[model samples]
Target chain A: MKIVVCAKYVPDATGDRKFNADNTVDRVGVDGVLSELDEYAVEEALQIRDATDGEVVVVTVGPEVARAAVLKSLQMGADSGVHVLDEAIHGSDSAATSLILARAVERQRPDLVLCGMASTDGGMSVVPAMLAERLGLPQVTFASEVVVEDTTVRIRRDGDAATEVIEATTPLILSVTDQCNEPRYPSFKGIMAAKKKPVETLTLGDLGIAADQVGLDAAWTRVDGFTERLPKSAGTVVTDDNGSGADQLVSFLVSQKFV
Target chain B: MSEILVLVDHADGSVRKTTAELLTFARRLGTPSAVFIGAGIESARDALRQYGAERVYVVDSPDVGDYLVAPKAEALAQLVQRTGPAAVLLPSNAEGKEIAGRLAIKTASGLITDAVDVTPADGGVAATQSVFAGSYTVNSAVTHGTPIVTIKPNSTTPEAVEGSAVEERVDVTISELAKTARVVERKPREATGRPELTEAAIVVSGGRGTGGNFEPVEQFADTLGAAVGASRAAVDSGWYPHAYQIGQTGKTVSPQLYVATGISGAIQHRAGMQTSKTIVAINKDEEAPIFELVDFGVVGDLHTVLPAATAQVQARKG
Candidate 1:
């Protein structure tokens, strides 16, 4: 079995996101981390590889900076890595990103493709479905559990209100939700072995894709500008002078139409 | 001129409120048509008619509803090919978003999701998105294939218009690759008396300041017929279900009216609801960041304030 997990490197979600004078994110001094959600997808792929004794490959489409994302996946136990880097791939929206990923997946022809339900930075859970459309493949989003038996894979999904069991064949796309599983930390042995893994770096020209197919030019959406929120004026402070919490609260409530 | 298509979101053919909302937005760009994929058109027709759908394309195919979003998207893509629609509109829920994303790539069209507003541009549709946790409002236009837009609910009040509801049988042949995955079984959610969070017009949310007691917040939500939401802190504490969390890590809700009680308005929390039309916050701490974005604010203990407000709203309803 050949399993592929898509990875993206982004600013650490926990870090403070600062803005530059031009309104773009200030990445000069911020620490970068593996896209938190993608880690779960990589873990799921690694577990599947472990079960099936197959090769696990990680792919990412971004700048040289994105190399870290693919390397991180390798450190987590992936057997191979592919980085599709080019200036043309920059500024692509979710749609364009899916197009590029679909093309790359088509070339690799993996039996299974796994992705995080949504990227933490974009928060737009559109890639899996978009890739499914581009590849003409069936996909299930927000998968909580996956079980492969014979030719078919069974999945249990924890939806908003209920749990459902789903069955799909290999070569299917599964976008794992955050609740799927707790990702494992990279062990010392695994980290050591990752350095020996094959990491192939490819450019857009090598893929035979047009420059106009992605980036801001092909993007369906454009962000005009970002305006910082206005600071809040001081709120009215109702002093609890009497020290009776209930009475003071009632007085304030009545004043605000809570009564 | 090809008609614009809308995927009618319904249960038992009864068109959902968001379907009307999408149709209202659809009319701004082109001729509006409704694509009803599953069964129950008989029950859904009245609502679809009232929502200005000139044509209701019905796909009575069995496999269409048996699986997940794949078949529905294939059907929509098929319809798009034949009818040559200029654009497609879908509600921005999980299912709709997935289907829309697939359909856009299948048609090689420009797709935009989570749009808060839409209006006609020179020759196409202009859509707006509140991104980066509502810190930025983006105005965009699709420059590629038929523009596909998935709009958030409650972005605009749905307006009904009289239209001849014409039904057409849409032919959809499933692709071999489309069957890569199939849903083996489905179990409906146990009915909760409360409304769905995404569909609710009003949402009342609690946060860390709730002190692990959600009674007051829940009571206020129930009184106002609003969905109950929680902050990650509240959900992490098991004060509420993870599904009710509204934050970067949780659900994104843009209700007409959002009431935040005892929430400090963390950036993560604000990312989920800052676009809401009207915000109201109640917290004893004047320093709570939630007050920064709210149109109305009250500084007080929710334990004493909520019961009285619930009574007042209940009395008004009476």
Candidate 2:
């Protein structure tokens, strides 16, 4: 069996992340690494591959810098990496991104495709299902636990009200939640092995995707305007003395009608 | 008037608060129509009516309820084709977003998730999204097909308006691909008896300062009938479950009131709850960053502070 894990290189959440003038996130120079959430997907893929004696391939669609994301996954035990890098792919929305990824995954002909619940940067959580739709495959998303047996892939999805055990056949898309498993860090040996791993790069032309079909111009959604969040102002503070802190809090709650 | 389709999120037969919230918001764009894909439409119809649902489209099929989200997405996509609504609104939960994404692709529509607000604009709808962990707010509009939106809970108040929600049984064909993912079993969560964290009007959360003791936090939350949350630090340390985590990677909540105890207020934690209407924090460290966003701050140990606050609230209720 073959497993393909979709990964993204997102700006470090701790960094002062900024957007370019065109409203796209500036991903050029700022510190970036594989999206923390996608690590779970990579980990799940590796686990499934290990159990089934399968090959694990990591796929990403971004600028040249996004190779870091694929490299990180490769270091974490993937067999190889594919990076779809093209200038025309910049500012692609979820739909276009899924289209590109679907084409890339089709090239791999994987038995299973894995993705994170959502990218740390986009936080939209839409691409996995969209990718499944574009591929005409079943999707079991937000899986807290995934297990494979023969031709079936089963997952435990924990919702606010209940937990559901859902399963699908092979050649399906699955997006794992952060609670799925603890992602493994790259060992020194794994890092050294990743240096020799093959990394393939593809462009829109290579994927048979038209230049006009992607990029900001063809995106279904566009950022009309944006505003930087204002710095929060200081609030009233009360130091506990004579046990009056609770009284003050209760009074404030009453005033706010929270009581 | 063009109708706005709102997916009703519920459990068994009971409707969730987020459905009412979506209905309330849908009324702003067009006439509100509810799409109930699972069983128990009879029980959910009253709440849907109260929330101004002009019509309730019911698809009470085991093919939808006994499976994952794909069938529901297919059903909604079919409904969209049949009705040609202005927009479709769903709760921005895990399942809702998955269904919305598939529906978007199936209908060749533009999908927006985790929208803080949606209003009529340019004959479509404009959605305001809080992105980059709430460091920026972006206004967006769909340029392609119909706009499919998934809104966060507590983005607006659920206003009850009297409307006769006439039920319409809609027949939908569940695609073979959708039926491949079948739900084998469902295990009901052990009821905390407390309200759900996202839908609760008041939320009392504990952080690393609790030192693995959620007793005081639970006591305070119970006293006020609020839900309980935990900081990522606390959750990472195995002090609480990840489901209870409130942070950038965890569930984002915008309750009417949010109280943080013993939390240092890291940006990740703030990213989840900063949109809360009113915030109050208590910590021994007076300089904790959590105080910056709080409307009221108390400098004291959570062990000493939360108990006292709980007593005060209980006594007031008595």
Candidate 3:
């Protein structure tokens, strides 16, 4: 069995994030690391590989900085990595991104594909389903727990009002929620070993995708403008000197029509 | 005016609040129509009619309930082909987003998720999204096909405007690929008797300041009939379950009233609740960041302040 995990390199949430003139996020000079959510996908892939004695391949689509995302996955027990890098891929929307990812996954021809529920930067949880649609594979998404048994994968999805048991056969796509499992840190030995692993690089031409089909110009949706949030101004503050804080709060709630 | 298809989110026959909100918003751009996917259209019809649904497209097929989001997407896509609606509205939950994404691909449409607001623009729809953990607001419009939008819960208030909810059955064929993911069983969650966190009007949340005890938070939430939420600090400390977390990684809630108890608001935590209409913070430390966005701030111990507030609310109601 071969399990492919899709990962992304996103700007650190704590770093100063800015947008460029093109209304795209400026990820060039900022601190970039593997998206915190994708770690769960990698961990799930490693667990499945350990159980089935399969090979785990980490795939990513981004600039040169995104190679680190695949490298991190390799250090965490993945066998190999595939990085799809190109200049024209910048500012591609989720649909275009899924197109490139589906092409990459076709080259691997894996039995199972996994992804995080959403990316930290875009926060759009639509790529996995779009990829599944493009690849013509069944998707079991937002899985909190996953169990594989004899060419079948079952997952527990916790919804707002109920918990559902969803199952799909092998050669399917699944996106795991953050509740799946705790990700492991890379060890010194594992980091050293990852340096010797093979990391394959591909371009849009290699994947048979035209440059006109992606990039900001080809995006179906474009950001017309963006505004930074204003600093929150302080509201009314009261000290409970005479044990009247609760009363004051009630009065304020009444004034604001919150009660 | 062209029709705006609102995907109804419901359980059995009861309509969810998001559907009503979607229908209310849909009336702003075009004529509002609802697409009810499973059985129980009769149970949901009154709410649909009350919220200005001109028609309800019913598809009572076992394939929709038995499979995952694929069949539902297919059904919606088929309706889009038949009705030629200007836009499709769905709630921005996990299932809704997936169905929207698949429907976009199937219909060659532009998809937008987590939109806080949608309005008519240049013969199409323009959407506003809170991105980068609510630090940036982006306005976007689709340049391609019809817009398939997934709106966030609590983005709009539901307003009743009576209309006819005449049911029309939609015909669709579920593809072989969509039938691969089958739902085996469904177990209802243990009822907390409180409103859902995302849809609740009031949310009372605790953080690390609770020191691993949520009893006060639960008590306060129960007294006010509000949903109980926790900051990431509390959830990471094992004081609360992850499902109850409200932060960048957890659920985003835009409730009418949000009460913060013992939480020193981090940006991630604030990202989830800053959009709430009214906020109140109670913490012992006067310098907590949670006080910055609150409409009212109480500098007192949460253990003391929350119980007092709960008692006051309960007494006033009685």
Please tell me which model should have the higher DockQ, number 1 or number 2.
Answer: 2
Candidate 2 chain A worst ten-residue window by lDDT? A228-237
Q: At residue B156, what lDDT does model 3 achieve?
A: 91
Model 3 ranges off by over 4 Å: A238-244
lDDT of 2 by residue, A1-259 (tens): 7999999999988888888989888888789999999999999999999899999999999998899999999999999999999999999999999999999999999999999988888888989988988998888888989989988999988887788898889899999988889999999999999999999999999999999999999998888888998867768899988688988999998887777
User: What is the TM-score of model 3 when looking only at chain B?
Assistant: 0.95
Q: What C-alpha lDDT, on a 0 to 100 scale, does residue B247 get in candidate 2?
A: 80
The segments of candidate 2 whose C-alpha lies over 4 angstroms from its true place after superposition are: A241-244
Quality of model 1 by C-alpha lDDT: 0.79
Clashing pairs in 2: none
lDDT of 3 by residue, A130-189 (tens): 989999999999899999997999999988768999999989999998789889999999
Candidate 1: which pairs clash?
Answer: B13-B44
DockQ of each: 0.43, 0.76, 0.73
**Best-fitting candidate, scored by DockQ:** 2
Per TM-score, what order, best first? Answer: 2, 3, 1
